[model samples]
Target: MKTRNPLPIVRLAVAIAAAIGSCLPLARCAAEPAVRPPNVLVFLVDDLGYMDIGANNPDCFYETPHIDAFADSAMRFTDGYAANPVCSPTRYSLMTGRYPSRVDATNFFSGKRAGKFRPAPLNDKMPLEEMTLAEMLKTKGYATCFAGKWHLGPDEEYYPQNQGFDVNYGGWTRGGPYTGKRYFSPFENPQLQPDSPPGDHLPDRLARDTAQFIDSHRDQPFLACLSFYSVHTPLMGRPDLVEKYEAKASRIVGEEFAREEQVLGDKPRRVRILQKHAVYAAMVEAMDEAVGKVLQQLDDSGVRDNTIVVFTSDNGGLSTSEGSPTSNLPLRGGKGWVYEGGIREPWIIRYPGITQAGAVESTPICSVDLLPTVAASVGYELQHDVDGVDIGPLLHGESLADRDLFWHYPHYSNQGGIPSGAIRHGDFKLIERYEDGRVHLYNLSDDIGEQNDLASEQPEKVDQLRDRLHAWYQRVDAKFLQAKPDGPEPWRP
Candidate 1:
């Protein structure tokens, strides 16, 4: 009659057995590792500012409920950075896990369009030699897909199909569909006649194709890179959505939405205002909805727990047309400069058991780190040299040692910015301008706004940072012009 206590002992044994079962596989795998690859979903937004989402900046013009919720459900990195200050270069570093200058494709391509200020860029594709995170995951038998924008390289020779993605859609437009020729139209504009629209709306099409890819690949481990092109330039928004934002913008302006701007190519004064601020805000809202759809599909497919979802942007928020008047106030310059706003982005990583939700990590992590981090997560070892270290440890609440991060933007930008290179060593940052050979140094911990130029007073600090930047350039074989013949000495401390 007293033998009923077997229930307690039985439960204890079961718990022990379960623990051993989990540990045993990991031990066995370490000896002869079978891949421990988890599904990866990278939701990349374009031209998203540091303060765009409510989780990052509650007072942003647009309300991104989905993005804010996702950030809350994930581990957010406050000091996350993009490799470059501008789009194409930032993306080059993102996909290749190396600096864009290394690839020698740091500028935007114009699809054979020639003009005074614009020069023909080297081929747009991320060279075949570079290994992409998507490609690396394929080694572990993972299904790969890329949706949204792909401004990496030229098509045919360097399309997503060749870059380790099993499926890709709506990614290969030159510059932007809205600004480019008929071939790149945003809507069923002049370009729809021949190539079949990338879809009704660029973001919608990317989202739809992405959902389909997940549905088809749910049975297996997958690496989905869903890069949304919403919020970028050429603000040709969906008509219904445009009307919604038009009312919002009109109320803010205390006037009706300018009909002149809506007339298509009318080039009114209000045209820049509507396209840049109003359409940009609407695009962000659309991108947020698109992300929600993909996340919903993952849940419905029964793979939410086993997937690692990363949300980030290519670069800082675009400060010009199609962007909100949000403040990177303290962050200094916007896109195309060596300031916080241009290169800083919101980074969130969600992995069920491995990472804690609603956590914020202040360690500096950049897009280049994604390669090694994802590689390690998927149980793959990287043999080649990677500029960015694995940030997986930081995401898991480990103490990250101090390290220096550097950036180089060699080309000129149309956004009223000069060529600059910056080096971040701990709390201090040194920015050097190639045009005037000026150095502006700031202790970022004290001045996130970059208001004071301490270089004048701190000669020792300036020399130290300059030495580090030059050494790094030499080590990486970075591309830089040998100061133009007529220009003054471009190298200065």
Candidate 2:
């Protein structure tokens, strides 16, 4: 037994040798701190209209001083778009870098309302096989975290922590902060603190959780996806902010409601043309404060320069439904339509040292492009095929090929938007309505409001764009409207 104890002595000698080796000026231990890897932060707001922020529309009703200042320091996209007109489909695209239509995940999860026809066989959950942004970042030795709004799946298996995140705070099955007083204290969200005071707000709390994650993971690379549930529905705001906006809104004078051209449904819906919703305005400002707090944390952690920040929305604002809270005035159609207002989002990217301050890019970008862009930015090579191209070139003050952008949403939007597919090629865009196969064409450069229809005038362009859109449907295996029990068969692509 005493002779066999030599193994312990050998272990002690090895430990001493390793400790001395670490202190030695070896390349792995001593080369300028080895330059900690870059970090990624994706800030997503829910149902936020493009013009709702002061950066896009300064004369607008709501105030977003923090967002405006951030826009001044970041690169703004004039032609950014989501993958669909609704939230879930667009969210799926951002996670997988693939068109939501590929899996028939076109409608918002579990949404199957039959308008003129039954919605296509719905795929309600994001497939677990898909490599999410968090999973990919993890391969690069980065800690991943997701906070707020995980509406991708119907159960826990599809939640962020299961998908790839090491930390998940306030992300669960429900889309909105629908716990306790809804957005106030005692959230009752199992993933978040449940015993908060009545006055505590959801957005601010989510931001604090995210800031703490950054501080804890500051020693290593990390990806913090702070997706907010603010300004979505069941509108509520800080009482002080509500009062502030109420006073500010009183000074403005204009009609609040305007008749939107009847796009679908039996009756015409009134869209809020004025941005004077006091509660919504307050929510916007509070969300801005949350954004500002996270940005400040980046500086406090001494990781600001090493981070790539992105800001966008899941879909367009709630101008046509759920109270018609805000207006998408110049942009036709809100949350559910296949028009500019439903899909054109306010996208911004800030790459500290690499990007110019207050720079603007006119190139068209989609939600799917996010995965590949972040991959390239972090020097990670993607092994899976994706529908989105890397817009990293555009971010570097270079150019991207004039490629086409596409969207597919086959469900009746709770808002006034119809089931349709749209394609944007150069300045010409075409919308294909599913009920009767009728197409509406507009030159977006000439008609940002999408008022003038050129389908009859530009038949050849229509044919060209329509052909391209059909080809995409085939490529993505897109699904469309289904016939009802006694109803006419819906049009097929």
Candidate 3:
């Protein structure tokens, strides 16, 4: 009649279940069902050169304490490169993980300049059919926000919002901050309404907007693309910073800071041998300050530990032209040239648990690599073919197998660069000019400045690299410059 004491039996069964659960894998009985996805913060600086930051350039004049400190705490890629030597194309590559040539967006949006040969067909807008990084992440329930420059398309239909960003701020067609009276607000952007106080700097306002977006979306995974419209054209900076740089410029020691000139074609391009443009230095400092503000916000929101931060530029500095602002010296030509200076960039990535702090990877990485690396980080499977390989292994202190890097810019650059296609298979790089098909080879390890041409002595190496470059062009279905029907004019700078 005791009925086997059912209550005692039930208590014993519960105790046994607890013990088994404790012995099982933590993931099986974790209090938190799933770990939250890390947030992504991309700091895309316009026209920032490879040697612009103190970590890359030992004697850089501009004060980039924030960026330098960031590099010191992140993984620095010494041979990082942009997908193109121009803005829109590199930006497109960043978003799509494909070469700009594949989408026919090889130049800045609405860029119609003609040269000796007619430029290849241009795609003014990024096609909606192609998946964007934001779009891919959005599928995984991430909030995507874009702040600052968006030159992907000419119309509103192809803007950040239409391209999977839930929030778009200051994104428009123009490449530079040419609207809203340039840089300072009353910005002419339709997506971004002017709400800040008058005379507020654009970079600072964009940073604040990004911080606000992060604050609002703190509980969820988010992608905040902070593309700064700084160190671009209409180089304007805060007055106090400008004054400080001017004072610094005045106290310079010798003719050690003299400007040099080189003839690229018929025109003499003034090369900035030194990094002491007062206004430009100020602009760089302001941009760095803006970056500092965003980083500080991440710290304040307590998400710094779980956020992946990437800092890079669309292309090299605007040294050869466009006010000749900053310098990319000891590397060769500036933005638009298919040289070390034009494509090489200051790339830094920070992933709290994955990447070792202060590590340096000399293995060259391109802007297209960003999407795949980020996708891998978030456990997203990429369905489309991407030109860039996931560099996640490199982040973890492993070396990637040597691969050929390619660049094809068939149109003449406004910055005094000729049309050319280049490829680097190893320590050597071969550049083939579209005008004459003449190839120039350089041993980048020995001649980082690209001063010596070793094509004659290294003919076989040139042939090998050229063949690989042409093969890549065919693989990517790259378009080439066509001879004008009226016959090509004499090549000019």
Candidate 4:
């Protein structure tokens, strides 16, 4: 008789307790909160091309098995692009999430004297006015580290530490660590010691540093930027891979042809290029292996599921105009031009909850998008003005409204030819040559080669893009001719 028909009262008591629990202060809550935040690992390759990865083009000169494996677990961005045509500028854009031109750094520098147009001092690095991604992430209670190339600035005022990186293992100067004697060397080089080296290879050395960073901070949220200087000029590779490439080069560039050209006192056009490509391929392979090592470290650390990994290059592959002219074939021109080959680079993002594995995001995204994208991903609030919009929606399979992408490469490059600006609106692209102020228009949807110049036929379209480009240039206060107007021509558009 004591417990008879008491079910209704028991239910009422349970409801009252639930209501009280919901009303209690969060601090007094019964369940302990999960304080974990995702880790971010960015593997930035130097001067990589559009078709470098197996996923982009399997028949590419450099076969990247490890990269393909990583791509298997990532989302491949087909239309990814660099913020600038060259290295230093794109790097600056990647770190700050702003266009390089806006900062008066439109070209690559190695702590050298600046040219007339770009009068900014190279001795000083990226302006302290700009906030770095690392600085912002550190505010969110994440441990930040930068391994490898840090070209934004060289002086103490511009060092990685000053930029908010807690620890920076191997990055100084404008270029990279020089291995052997060469035609040219960077101003400051931090040589790696052999016996206590991170790995036998330079790429592996950088990878090892990244692994250490991850291992030390796996329990907590971390931001590790691993920049590998592989496959750049002065192509160097492991002795074994070098030998393999040497054998391959010997067949491709036939000894008889090489000797015959020498006998005639003429250079064999194909011999040097063939040798370079072989070495270049090996360098790329080494870089891919470095990426593999980092991926493995993430997996072994039990934080792979919660880590968001991004892989990309600073700019397009170095063209024939530079030291080592890696090919960016079928896309026209490399490195310094306004062509697709110069700006387009490989991009892959792997995050379990945010991006789908094996997904392809062909939505156009520039290097400038990185800052806003990462900020959103890391749950950070950005106060500074950012030119790029958050591309997290695109990564999540959401549709973005059609928008035009513009570029302004003002300074004349040492190798890849003259100054230029370009605008990509939908499938149509308008290229403006600064040398002659000539406008070339092409529908990239139909012509990825950019072989045709349809400016005459598409006059109205050309004028529209040209005006829009310059209007933006004015809006950003882009670097331009100050001393003398470069002779006005008819506005064709």
Residue-level error in angstroms, candidate 3, position 11 = 7.2
Model 1: residue 129 alpha-carbon error in angstroms: 1.2
What would the TM-scores of all predictions be? Answer: 0.82, 0.93, 0.94, 0.85
Per-residue CA lDDT of model 3 for 40-86, tens digit only, reads: 99999999999888889879998899998999889999999999999
The alpha-carbon deviation from the true structure for residue 85 of candidate 2, after best TM-score superposition, in angstroms, is: 1.0
Worst 10 residues of 3 by lDDT: 255-264
For model 3, the superposed segments whose C-alpha errors exceed 4 Å read: 1-11, 18-27, 253-265, 488-493
Model 2 global lDDT (CA atoms, 0 to 1): 0.89
* Candidate 4 wrongly placed segments (more than 4 Å): 1-15, 19-30, 110-124, 179-199, 248-276, 323-325, 481-493
Q: Kindly provide the TM-score of model 2 when superposed on the true structure, using C-alpha atoms.
A: 0.93
lDDT by residue (128-181, candidate 4, tens digit) is: 878888998988999998887787775656778788899886676646656443
Count of backbone clashes for each model?
A: 7, 0, 0, 2
Give candidate 1 misplaced runs (Cα > 4 Å): 1-36, 110-123, 178-199, 247-276, 321-327, 482-493
lDDT of 1 at 49: 79
- Choose 3 or 4, whichever is better by lDDT: 3
Instruction: Return whichever of 1 and 3 wins on lDDT.
Output: 3
lDDT of each: 0.71, 0.89, 0.87, 0.74
Give me the candidate number with maximum TM-score: 3
Q: On a 0 to 100 scale, what is the lDDT of residue 249 in model 2? A: 86
